[model samples]
Target: MDRRIFIKNTSLATAALALPKIDPLRSANLAKNNLPKWKGFNLLDFFSPNPKPVSKPTTEDHFRWMRDWGFDFVRIPIAYPYYLSIDRTKNITSEDVYKINPEAVDRIDSLVSMAHKYNMHVSLNLHRAPGYCVNAGFNEPYNLWKDNEAQKAFNFHWAMWAKRYKNVSSKKISFDLLNEPSMREDMNDQLSKRSAVPGEIYRKVAKAAAEAIRKENPRHLVIADGNNVGSTVIPEIIDLNIAQSCRGYNPGIISHYKAPWANKDPDHLPEPKWPGQVGNQYLSRAMLEEYYKPWIELTKKGVGVHCGECGAWNKTPHDVFIAWFSDVLSILSANNIGFALWNFVGDFGVIDSGRADVAYEDWQGHKLDRKLLNLLMKQ
Candidate 1:
């Protein structure tokens, strides 16, 4: 199906504006439980700056906690480089890339099993694909969109995962094809125009990967993130029968205030306040609705919309963080969109996100933010 046609047909309908129900496919992994609105967190150990060994017991405990906390799913962002063999040279082919990373594969396999044990679904995302990653200064030797080998390697990686997880039900697991693909090297540039080039390239790559996975396991669900850090601007790839993912960090100043890594803030920017002024613009729920209009249109077309990543950075004041998160989650819930906060145990997590400014209590032997946790549970 042509993207133009999808946009034309989908834009005509209004958003469903309700949470997703459980899987209608009786045999699917999530058929019995539904999606639980997929309110969950991301497990980022593999992609963090300091990678740690995968501990089975620890992993199981995390899954257990997610289930106990009323969360439904977890997104595992795997850094592909961790699995690459140092002996291999740069710019390898798909076949070479596939055969080199057994350790990473084994680690993910164990985690996947743990998720199933606790009845928690998992989405495996290639945070660092063969040729592109959103991490700054960590440029791939080849351009993912222009390099033939990179494209082949990326598709092959998904195919490999499909074959490996062939028995896993689609409802239990999904493939978030790639992290955040953008047209320009710098991701934060002219987001609207940047969306066009990467949007088209991503469609081709995503469809190829989806086709490969479906060949091995037809029932597996595939998800693709939007350009510009999965912001609004959903590309017309829903025709591939895959779910669409976006980030929930709208009003960037509030979400990423003083966050250096994202570089979203400006010099001498005033303190970000929820529903307050950010320079000349007034940021509020109305703005959120306008930003999410594209995703709403997609959902009306029967496409599952998800916030694959969203949260306030630790640098933001705790009260402000809660306020911003509350508004974002409300917007998501009102529109029936599911989301996974940026992290599970890190700086943007429910448990021990290093926010000393907020009061915390011990729950299940973990330093838990009772207020934040309770708020999320209610949502």
Candidate 2:
């Protein structure tokens, strides 16, 4: 079915409650030295590293629907290999990383243009960068946190993107340097033990990339994802003046209950419950507040903070997902920190999520989670 026709036929009555207006004084303050609290979702058109069959292009209906629903931001998470000319059969080399594919880049350009056409802010993020990816499948030739060659290639890619969009206003677009920077023992093992990159190493890499980006356009805004896979804030690069991105998947037991990538044994895990005991630990809104205290405190120090990726897998019960997510959203919104859900569609989205428990609303042939959509819009 044509998504355009479907969107046109969908009802807007459920979205009538407009998003709360930004406080003028707070807006001015954040505009002066921090990032705006721009709320929206992540679009995964280029999320996969192997681009044999490119992901479906996001249509105009996406942008139109987002704007009409009161969302003003979209984070485009790209796997660097998706845009490079490389062999899928072999490990990616530093030389292969430098190979620029114009056709692949053109596809990205179209998405960015379409996003801006709807007045939505675009944040370009490298979910899979040159030398590292949090959840691994492809083999990386070198470690981004430790190898000079990998760092050089990383800067090279950021510089190329900076130069490409140098003419675009910082207000309309920003660069999220890398997604979920962390250290893992093996690049190709998804189950490898992972830990936070040392502060000095993360700082050095971020500083160099920020310099490369600014070398093209000093006004280009740059953002760095939180350390330890976006769960903790990075104090090391605060002085560099780069905004920081945080994650919303706290208490992984709740967010990734039956997900294979997050859990080694999805079938045997305890069922998730909000404000109740899951396994042995007690979870509640107070726990969530305490979890985000450091993040809120970081903002008080004048650092721009945003939740880059967040949401529960479809396997989580709908009631539990909504109940827990409500506390998550309420806390962030209260602190004036905006968030972008992990996705706009698919297993972790507000539309066509394929959750067996949800009484899905049919919107233009798409299964719309009106409950989830209403919750997001009210924020």
Candidate 3:
């Protein structure tokens, strides 16, 4: 079935899921337990995946907490660089990992197994992907499509993953082809124009990965995110066929508000909002409508879309953060799409990296308010 046409014909509900927690656009069939019956989610790597565990990430502990939080799924961002080698600009020579580092491989397996133990849906994404990602700092010297070697290598990696996870069913796991693919090099120069380039590349890599996945796994949902990494940037790709994920944070605005690149960074202008405010840093319901309208349209057209990752800066007030999350989660719930917070805990992690309850509000564990969890758990 042609993805374009197939998407064109499906009712919007089957396509993208949203929250805002009103009457769901789609029917909310209660499970045997009669819960809200939404597709649940959690943002993975609450703290950065420390190559050195006990010292960095509290691996097993976080997973246990996720399960305890009642989240139904988890999305893990995995980068291949740990296994592959590129030159100074970090340009991937073959797109394939030259070494497939043992540590990286072990962590990947461990995360997957951890999710399985809890019966949570696991989404594997290629973050800071070899060829391209939003992190220009990490991109070194790579460009999508322009590098044939990278493209081929990317294809090979997907093929490898498809085969590797062939046995991992969607019931327990899924795969996001790549994190955020900038269509062109000058995304910040002129987002309006740069957005379109990624569509073709995404289709190429995503379809290749999907085909590879379907050939083996058969049921794992293959999701693809829109350009700008967020639904707001490119309205055109919103209705695209692949499953969708978006990076909703405003660069240096909220989560990255203070990031050094926000100013000099060409990708985005720094206009961060302060926390504990309603209209500024937090995304409101109307804001969600504007930001996610494209995703809604795509779902209307028949693609499985979801708000994969959305959260504010850890420095923000917990109450303010909760309000923002409340609003965003409500919007996602209304639509039935999955939502994962930026992290469960850590530097950029949900917990103070891995100290568990040791830190201040920064620690993911201490910061987790049961009230918030209960509210989110409500169908």
Candidate 4:
């Protein structure tokens, strides 16, 4: 066996979860099946993909791109203020309606339907979720896992979504449980006590979220982006018998390759900017394998995995990104892990930003990254 396969096979056997007392979302999940065929894509940051004011064509063109690109699905990450009342400001005092927004529901349905029109599969993800997220001000509110109310609210978000989309189909749609749940203590005691311990809360939250989403739809693939500090710790996820999934964000390395996000995060993380610091010795293949090991291990053992997002920032050198992507796509396809590039076009646009009417470059001399189309279409 090749080094990658040998190492991953060994790892999967070690990470299997002793059957938990809590019923798994899909009862059949316990029975072995072929790893789900996943050739999906992710669209984020570009449109906020959130409930925020969204342009219809913004999503329309994106769906078109996925079809043309030969990708089978698209995973969407969105932000919602479920903790607050629908007025968009009031903190939920004592109301169930306080937990979700119908507008978010409506808009998201629109996007899902659009994808369905294209015959593309979909995974709707809560990106900058109620209180849990990497963005500084949004650290989860209560003891995320242990708290009854918080778990209820968290579970409600998916339960409600599943109620709406459960009939969509495991073939056409899936729901990621949460985006990059992590253990960051940067919030200076702002988040409530129970949710305070990062690792513990996240685990509890994961179980609850998974159970709830599964409540409404057992077959849909509900993924939990690895619980590392935020996609950096797939190895840790393997320990949890958590499905192998990664957000594929290494700011200075790829997406932030050269754009100016280094100090962008509030003080807690002063991660550097573009072409920032991926070590010179780090060839794309090495990076892909290291990042991919967890997923490879899971799938070989009959556990399904997904690469939720992967794309470089348009600000960085496109050529460098194209070269890196060649290896990343090959690994994902080889392993049968579904992936979504970060966006179609907008801030990190693949089409809309720099090129104006053209599909490639938005600026002079910087032609569109010709490799992008080929990379996505690769089998």
**Cα error of candidate 1 at position 159, Å:** 0.5
Pick by lDDT: 2 or 3, better one: 2
How much lDDT does each candidate structure score? 0.74, 0.89, 0.56, 0.58
| Candidate 4 per-residue C-alpha lDDT over 125-208 given as tens digits, one digit per residue, 9 for 90 to 100 | 777554455444433445343457756776777787788877777778777776766544542132322222355566667767
* lDDT: worst 10-residue window of model 4: 187-196
* Tens digits of per-residue lDDT for model 3, 1-379: 9998877767566545543455553455211211122244444432232233334443667667667767777777766664443343443344234546555676677767877887777777777555665544343335555666666666666667777777766667677777766665552242233454544655565666677667675666677766655544344433433566655463334455334543355345434333334333564456655765555555555556666676655454455445556666665666655677666654444444322222344334355444445656663
In model 1, the Cα lDDT at residue 133 comes to 72
Ranking by TM-score: 2, 1, 4, 3
Q: Best by lDDT, which number?
A: 2
How many clashing residue pairs are found in candidate 1? 3
Residue 114 of model 2, lDDT score: 96
Which residue segments of model 1 deviate by more than 4 Å?
Answer: 1-36, 48-58, 87-96, 137-139, 186-198, 264-267
TM per candidate comes to 0.83, 0.91, 0.71, 0.71
Error (Å) of candidate 1 at residue 370 is 1.2
Per-residue CA lDDT of candidate 1, range 1-379, in tens?
Answer: 9999888767655343344555555223121212336888888767742235643223577777789889988898987766665433354444545555587668778877888889878899998887777774343556678788888888887888899999988779999988876766543232223434456777787888899889998998898887666775455576788887889888778887777766644456778877788778887778877887787667767778788998888777888878878888877776677889888776788887778697889866777887888878887
Error of 3 at 115 (Å): 1.3
| Cα lDDT tens digits for candidate 2, 216-309 | 9999999999999898989999899899998889999999988999888889998799989989999899999899888888888889999999
Model 2 stretches with alpha carbons more than 4 Å out: 1-33, 54-56
Ranked by lDDT from best down, the candidates are 2, 1, 4, 3
